[model samples]
Target: MIQVHAWADLDYDVLVRDMRAVAFDLDNTLASSKQPMSAAMTDRFAELTHRTTVAVITGGRYELVVSQVLDAIGGRADRSRMHLMPTGGSRYYRWHVDDDGCGRWKCVYAHDLSETDRRAAAASVETRARELGLWETRVWGERIEDRGSQLTFSALGQQAPETAKRSWDPDDKKKRMLVAAVSRDLPHLKVRSGGYTSIDISLPGMDKSFAVHELARVLGVEVGGIVFVGDRMNPGGNDYPAAEAGAYAVRVGSPDDTLRFLERLLVRL
Candidate 1:
């Protein structure tokens, strides 16, 4: 088993120098929950891409990645050096740079769930959450979403503010109950905790583990040469799968911590 290291404890110079790629979790790692990258983060991330291959693997859809990350960095960054694996690596997008310097994203692969699987996951998620009294009475936006390759259940609704999301189930108790119940009903599907208060349902083996290998394969690097950084590396956290996949995983406290690490890595690279 791989040991998760605290951001402060890592040898940034050695790690950054040897790593072929750096992958990040979107929410709480690269940006605030459901929010765009901050100005500092955008600049640093754009710069980092120019130095080494980068990727953002999230439970969010392609649209969210574009809105929350790519849009913020714009053409300033080297998109060709980056990969976007949305929906927990169920879908992968690569960038194609044009002769005029404009870049376009291409969907190289997608593992979208079938309609039957989507229906089953959505039903199981809602039914189990309600049965366990974990479903909220009121929500900010959507409680359940069909994200093409994944079905997500957000406890406090998809549009819940960052503050509310942070406070909803800090202990992960509520999400644990919901995830367990849903998983039992959908034995063939993969269900894991996502973002701040969301549960992601995807095809079996289609988690961050899949993302790690996919990134390495696409980048033509060994799995050990990739460094995945995220806020969640605990057993049930979505980021755990990356560690399980044999990548050097470092756990950070928040996006600020992630930014600081990126700065150190940039200096080393």
Candidate 2:
């Protein structure tokens, strides 16, 4: 018999009564950059949803983010209670499409920085950077992800190699260094690291944390009614949004760790 960790065998009557919903940050929370959640996680999530709503919020693009849902939670009927908020809290969609195939989808804020501006900004930033010799551009498909906002710098014109782009700073440490360096140069913009390899800049107050708060209004639950789990909870990271919303923040170890975390949460609730 598989020896389930003590985490798998917990009592949940305490921490759950007030929890109207449970939100998770994708990537490291639900699935690691390398693997998806194990069966243990999906089953645990299924178990948890029997008591409270579950939502997933991530900085990953929408198309890619939903696939994670399909993987860990394919056919659970309570899926209607599951929510998927993607793009750094820039988008929201509830689980379960209605008869016509639509439940709830909201795109709060987005921007398109095309190649001209990308070139202009990159030229400005890179040229100044050259003068300072502080930074270099890792061109990815004419799309200058000035952080993660997806600037159409090259009009999505010529593409850059995904392998090369991802390798630019796989751990995101280099990207963090780049954010600090560029923000020092462009102080007016809010520059921060997101996902695994991207740096994003936005106007102040343009972030997912606030987005979660905004999205909470739709759930009709106080921000405090939600418990958010995520791996990245640093000051300017993507997961910071959920942590900031007055929600209970549960930090876990890996992509699959969330499953066990949920199981513990369910039993303890």
Model 1 clash pairs? Answer: none
Candidate lDDT (C-alpha), each: 0.90, 0.58
- Give the runs in model 2 whose Cα sits over 4 Å from its true position: 1-13, 96-173, 184-189, 202-204
TM-scores for all predictions: 0.96, 0.68
**Which numbered prediction scores highest in lDDT against the true structure?**
1
Clashes of each: 0, 24
Model 1: per-residue Cα lDDT over 1-269, one tens digit each: 58887888899878977799999999889998778999999999999989989999998888989999999999899888899999999999998877997768999899989999999998998899889887888789989999989999998898899889888888899888888888899999998888778899999999999999988987788988989999989888889999999999999989999989988788887
Q: What is the C-alpha RMSD of each candidate to the true structure, in Å?
A: 1.4, 7.0
